[model samples]
Target: MSHVSSICLRNSAFSLLVSVFILMLTACGDLRESKVDGYGLPVVQIEMNSETLGLLLGQVTSKRPVAAEVKMQGDVKMKCEVSFAGQSSLNDYRKSLNLRACKNHPSEQTRFRLAAQNRDKTTNRAILAYEMFARTGMTVPTTELVSAYVNHDFLGVYLLTEPISSEYFHRRGIRVADIYQSKFGNAGFRKEFSSNLSEAFDYEGDGKDNYAALQGVYKTLWDNLSDEEFERRIEMQIDVDNFMSYMATAVYTAHWDGFDNNYFMALDKTKRKLIVAPWDLDRVWEKAFEFNPADFLSRNQLLFRMMTISSFRKVFASKLDLLLENFPVEVQLSNLEMKKAHSQSALAMDKVNGPDLEASFDGFEEQIKVWNEKIRTFRNTIAE
Candidate 1:
């Protein structure tokens, strides 16, 4: 109870409070330094040894991957395998990259794709297109614009996207019996266009022969059937609503490469029918404003055949109308503006594919206006 004892107790409490304050300040400092951009996009930092880097760069034609380490948003370093992604993109100075977390890593998703956006001037086409698809209730991979670095070298802004795989469907709680991806060349449903099924679609299953019955049914659906019979049979093979949504979105976005190529089909076991999803939307929004969906459909025999069915045509028109109503031109233009503001700093710093950011945005705005007008005109004809 002495005065000195009281003073000692007070001093101890003050010191404890000071220690707590210092700890709080240190925690805040760590958060402030984390790898996030002004727009809340994660900055991915990849580090590889000089020898491994040389191996990846030298073998541009090879799909082999090399070991590397990745750190995202100040998280713990994780072991990953890195490989050069894309076919023609390898020829570009700013090459795309694919990353897969090692088994020991603590992440749920193992694979990720970082698109170089070399061909896109604005560097926002794929991200924006994915957003549009998501809004329309279409199954689309998660996409974001990220600033990327490899071995302390800046690779500028890249589109970080989810690759289609079993892991992707598993995350969404969707079960599938088989998955197939359509590559370039004759990817349509015309039997004559493709020498065999494998030529058009690459079966992503362990054994292609396992799905022989399903593949055979798909190929022969067009042969020896009345229009009514064909509709009944085709409905068993593909989810009509899902396919219509995909086609509508493709037409809406002017995804020129998507109709016959750059698409995926998975056998949805729960629905007992195949479901379609789009991939590689970098070529979207590049078509002229006067784009014709009919002309686009003519290239794909399956789509052209479906258009012959009155019910299918009605459903597709309805889907397209819904998309236009839900995602208006004003909202789209606003999104573009927000994205441009968010990515201006990163785009400005892109040295390899130095994009004219402002010019690109202006061009995108003009194209969007024309594209919307074209689709709206088509919608009116459907109404007529």
Candidate 2:
């Protein structure tokens, strides 16, 4: 809750390969071109609720596929692609086929939708939350709120978005140990993160480090595996470390589905290579919302506890400052807003998690807007 300045440059960017994207792209041809001029990238347009714009634009990536966004409300809605084309994502079908995916969008785009039910409305509250966050100057993708209608039925709001490549750092071709050594040779991850950020901007995770691969590292350290397996195990183990570090940042940012955000790619912006980038953030925020409401609560899971404890924090502390700063305002705010919304949803879910989910989604739309405006006002009041 306290504005964490030191965490502005928490130094936690890296590459992660994504299974979903790879799977989808395997067949090829489903890219959506965007209207934006500066960057000639393709964007995925989904129906977005203006209220949750920040939530919609978590982090944009500089993938081979660029992103553009549009938001809809009123009678407008979005469509999804059921089939694959070249390397297109679902949004491609929306534009090519001229379909609405938000509500009344065909079943191919949205499986959860019902005849009279507009399941994909992007509530006004959600849009506001997203907008407020974008203004914060975090690295969020472009956003838009779209309208929805099914078979001529009116569905309220939806979101348009540009997806960032989940793997940001690995694509950059930098090693974690190299990054750590370059910044703070002797220091551990957390300490070096603080030191490096205090000096300047640094958000790359070391490629040499892998926590998940710790098992593999142990295998190598103890000489228990075959050569090829050892190499593969070490590689995966390094990623585990990277994943854990990335997850640690998520706790601070309160992102979810970030596990799915894991994708890495490298691009040569200039002659020099950059670190892996466009990390998909998950668990945007449950903590802030949990802190907000009187009736909200979650079971204290041990793994989560371990994630937030000092030991975890110590490992993640260094990257904390830079990551927050590096993160776009919308990305940060969306998580904050989502936390509250999720809590409220949780409360409602205790009543019922499924069926009639639209009402619950709509109810929180306004909350997102209010939350966003408040942040904007606070930032404006600051002596920036």
Candidate 3:
């Protein structure tokens, strides 16, 4: 009887130890999983009713928003409206999303964009663009690399960015009389494109007729006035210094889509001048490092008119020289490395577009070198 009792006691002790060991392993695993990586990029989880999600998924091309709930760790869970965003990315398997916090929400930020990065294999192009722009003292959207989940499924890495809105300007203490976003590719300030001006730009103000001012000042005046008068009118309507900086940044970054489209024009309430801001920078840095600065002037009438003015041309050259001198190549490379490390796991898990996405870092250094050389050559040519 004593031996049997001893055997039972040992078995019971062994069982209890095994259970405790399993529990400890689970706790450690959980801790490891919870550890934030990549400079503490937050996780944003969105939940929505199945029916609404289905409706959203059904319309690939529609911009109509659907109701949903958004929750970011350490932030208030709020009701939000979700919609498909981006022109070319709409058909992508991993579609970009636009989220707007419903009115009366406690959150300070009302609108934001989640870039799918479907075309950006490096996932850092937009981020690099914004960083470069910010270095030049340009107002750009703040961005973060985040792991996004919807309906309890991991959707992969997303670039969480602030949308250009009233809130965006308000945060920076900027007062704008009007805001217009270029919606179509024909948003150039040319008399030929003026007919489609309404289709090209979406005005955020009360009166659509306000677009006539933009046309009259930037297009009609250029055609009807002498060079001196046109320059005077242009300087009054547009902040020439700001515009020059914007052009320099756009050219240096190879932002092919930004000059006439994928940009915002805000009329400053104080200065009463139009300020250009860049958006959708994903298309940059992909082309070969061989482009003439002159090529850009021909594409937009506003650019052509500005470049024709000798004084404005000098300003633009100065801005370009300043940009090239202060280009943060090493810092940008380090940023790319950090983002790659942080997003590696998510990218691997991105079954939709990950497999097709090439490893962009392999040629990144060489690309940067070539770009720098080309830009320097162009600058020297322009100097002569």
Top lDDT model: 1
lDDT tens digits, residues 1-384, model 3? 344334434553222212222333323222122322322457776666545654564454667888987777555577889887887775454578889865444647788888877767767788877877776677999897787766445666788888887788878888987788987777766576565667878887655447755775656444677888888888888888887788778877777777788888888888888887788888776663556555666667788777777898888788777777677566556767776776666666555536754546656555665666666776775531
Clashes of each: 0, 111, 0
Q: After superposition, how far is residue 261 of candidate 1 from its true place, in Å?
A: 0.6
> lDDT (0-100) at residue 127 of candidate 3?
86
RMSD of each: 14.6, 18.8, 12.5
Per-residue lDDT tens digits for candidate 1, residues 1-384, read 544334434553222212222333323222223343423456887766545654554444676888988776456576888887887676555567788764444556788888877768788888888877776677889788887866444567888888887778878888987888887646667666433677777777655435553465556455768999889888888888888888888888888778888888888879988888888888788875556655677656777788788898888888888888877788889988998888887788776434577788898888888888888887776531
Which window of ten consecutive residues has the lowest lDDT sum in model 3?
Answer: 13-22
Ranking by lDDT: 1, 3, 2
Clashes of 1: 0
- Pairing residues by index, what is the TM-score of model 3? 0.83
Lowest lDDT 10-residue stretch of candidate 2: 293-302
For residues 41-102, write the lDDT of model 2, one tens digit per residue.
11223322222222212221222221122223323334432211111222221211122222
Give candidate 2's whole-model lDDT. 0.30
lDDT computed for candidate 3: 0.69
